[model samples]
Target: MSGLSIPIHPITHNPTEAWEQIKPTQRVIKLNVKTPTTPQNENMLRFVCMSDTHCLTSHLQFEIPDGDVFVHAGDFTRCGSAIEIEEFNSWIGSLPHKHKVVIAGNHELSFDPKFTCGPAARQQHKNAHTGGGLINEIPDLGIERAKLKAAVEAENTVNLITNATYLQDEPLTICGIKLYGTPWQPEFCNWAFNLPRGKQCLDKWDAIPAETDVLITHTPPVGHGDLCCTGVRAGCVELLSTVQSRVKPKYHVFGHIHEGYGVTSDGKIIFINASTCNINYVPVNPPIVFDVPIPPGFSK
Candidate 1:
């Protein structure tokens, strides 16, 4: 079926209900990555996915399984401070994965131009009077406010992550699989990379390449892994429309709503919400792993 034919309206509020509604029509595969698994074909590439570490990689209690590719959906830092980025980079460098892909989350304010020097920054500046300064506007997150200010003002804050490929509306090919990463999501608490719902969000999704094999975003698509404990759906409706109808990637990986961590599918596309941290800000969730057959002419 074509993506355009899929019905995305009357957005489902409960993820379970949404899954049930499509269960019969779609083939869903829920894997337990925490347990030992049999070896797969050498021609396939294993992907280990995690997100929302929130600068707490050191607190992780479980061992990250080995994989050929490591994909971090987003939210690796608490406040996107320089120290946090450096620590994350250092930690990722220690991983055994041959290819690591990362994208900024809403918390990575320093990596987002719209939040640092655009209208959002101006708004923060205007509100600084109540809090003292831009640095003061942000709550104390262990990092000093003065240092955060410097990090935010620094050019090319994305460069701080040298260990992994940081993607922001860009594409990178790994083992012949074309993967595209985007960070924009619906406006949430005036966070970074936020755009108003509807056209603004749709425009960002439209930028995704149709030939993309793997799609990564900071936010989940509607009715997938986007249900919040508050009984609200936080995923992007426009993103779902774009994914189902246009991109149609083999895998759609994301993590923003910490509670919505799992794997779901629409029969056509596999949706994985690899949220490493739970709703309580604890790093208890395990990394999700999946394998994709190496495309023709591609060697791992």
Candidate 2:
């Protein structure tokens, strides 16, 4: 599967037009800084974000900027193997951030129950009801089902991530900020934690806490930072709806489309596509850093 090619589809919504139509009334600051620096205010908490490393942490060209919190938005591994998970955990453990949060991406095949042990896995088997027909006609791309099951049975891959706080449709608090992380995205090349574009994807987005201050997802909300180099938008439409209409977090962090790396805002919420890797799989992008003012009552 080294040279695997996934089909790309053009996104129906035009992000530029969408942003222009609902222009933010208030001035939203865009934080696409080059160097990492301490927060100017004592009450501000700095966040260092990176995603889509894909087992290339060692090849990063720049030092990970120091901050109060570190957020990894997924795709830390190429295939989510046990060795890859262990190496990622070790690399994360070396980071100095006091609070680190992580979530799975499509590449974390072993972490997703649906792909490892549920319907997706069953699709690999021959369908007896259809007279020995195969459910998925795509050739097996070398990911052995037996190995995945064996790895899961040996030990849960989630437990291997002991260094950072892993979230899956879960929430965690750091310095009074409510952060929720989810891995689901619109189905892309039938990877892990993927669901259909409509209701299934919406169902996952619906579980995000309404009071979340920061939203971390593997897939970018459509139009924010989801454009691929091939001129297609790889973002989830329902996710964009959920974020703007309901969650409305102060910052939305994500990285899946490697080419879509940067920061954008819609007058209200800030969106960050912190993909450390470029489209060529090189760790050329710098980690995104931002400062969030701590709530008056909250102490660091």
Candidate 3:
């Protein structure tokens, strides 16, 4: 990371036009960065992204194309099992990318409880789900004590990948850029980072500090990279609005809707839906790569 100074996209123009050769369907494993490969430049950088892996260890172990940073959108596990979480984390931390950032998908319930409840929340939810019955008041299942115990066990016991483990609501800096991962998703049955529409998820994006170089999430925004053949948009509308309007990251990477694999750009932001798994739940998609120039003075 010390001597690595290269401008991934060097032309003084729009990146989409410069990298138009890249396709949404064609499989590409590498993107070459020009001579300057470090973050000292004013504006240039490269990032690698993959999403919806669902615990495909082979894809995780296979050599990922080179880049300055690696971003995983979400769904690292099939059921957020302790085994799957460790397996994915171990594999993700090993990539050549200088930094690795990830968010929890609907599958990893242990870390993201926004969409889940401990015994108390789960019980309260169960009561409501059972009959939508009116309750004198929502009972706090009081499962925190037990939940914390389980969470600690997972983080400590599960094997670690690169000494970097899953971080919640925390920011990690790589090279000179800032990276953040939010595991929240749209409202759905008990799932990881689940948030309701409107105020629920928007509140999450408000915490992202400005100049965030990269944002990682499990679900894509409504229109950009999120689409379903079911004639419905299954992504988070609030996240889309907040990220595109507020964070304005150089890259927004996500996966969950497998069919959304590909690249979409709003002229300023490059959206990569890097799902390692396909619609049929197969690890067919390859890692997508991009070169981003790190402007001089980019923070650590």
Candidate 4:
């Protein structure tokens, strides 16, 4: 009745008594209506995952399929500088995915002061290029660190990237699925999210909720997807224990060791190293895609 064009049924009564005397024929009418079907994507959530873009968005040689959600494990910029972060943010904003989730990595020095202040790790991994701010090779390392810290404080470095949902030791729920994201990883090259190997890393992993459906971390758990070309296991053992024993997420997505871009499963869980870039710092790897069915009895 509110200006909507809906079907209406009409009835009329005969006033004369002769109407009843006369034989009347019955007539029936049926109205057919169509109900719209829901979109196929509405029934399932598709996640397109990638990581370690390293300020090489435009150079990507692969196509990212349309998806409901996009997950970036981190290291989107070469040095997490204002320019780098801004460019990354623009690229993230341009993605067609409905929801985008991201976390900071060791290379994102502007996001973490401790990483920028610490001396560079003795070993530098492949494609770990240095940009502005804290450069360990400089003769005046202290002065460089101080200068970087001053820039971060003055400009609020993290504020530069605001296009995606940034997570740091946080959990979020989307489309009836629980997601927890943290950037922390085993201490390496004194980068952001680096924590000492033993209890420190364990304490960080402990914060992950037991019901996390999708776990997004910059570093993979030990022996899962943390293999480097140098024949070293850069993952944290405590993190692996926590994931296998307690968290047990349906999908553990990460990317830091570029050489470890692939997928693995441990009977119960699926581990995806969705590194979009390769060891040579080339953004040639394809984005990983997976579908998660809607939970039973779940409604929007």
The numbered model that scores best in lDDT is 1
Candidate 4 wrong stretches, greater than 4 Å:
1-41, 115-154, 297-300
- Residue-wise C-alpha lDDT for candidate 3, range 191-223, written one tens digit per residue: 556666656566676776667877777778656
lDDT for model 4, please.
0.71
| RMSD per model, one decimal | 3.9, 7.3, 11.0, 23.5
Per-residue error at 281 for model 2, in Å?
A: 0.3
The CA lDDT of each predicted structure is 0.81, 0.78, 0.61, 0.71
Best-to-worst TM-score order = 1, 2, 4, 3
Question: What local lDDT does model 1 show for residue 257?
Answer: 95
Better of 1 and 3 by TM-score: 1
Candidate 2 Cα errors over 4 Å, as ranges = 1-31, 119-154
Candidate with maximal TM-score:
1
* Candidate 4: tens digits of C-alpha lDDT, residues 146-214: 443333343566776688899888998888888999998876776666776666666777788888889
* Residue-level lDDT tens digits of model 1 in 1-300: 133433344434343455455446545456434533867567998899999999899999899988888999999987687788899999999999999999989889788886478775677667655765555654555666666566676666788899999999999999899999999988776667877766677777877888999999999987778888987778776687788777889999999999989988776888999999999999998998888889999897
Model 2 clash pairs are: none
TM-score: which is higher, 3 or 4?
A: 4
Off by over 4 Å in 1: 1-36, 118-151
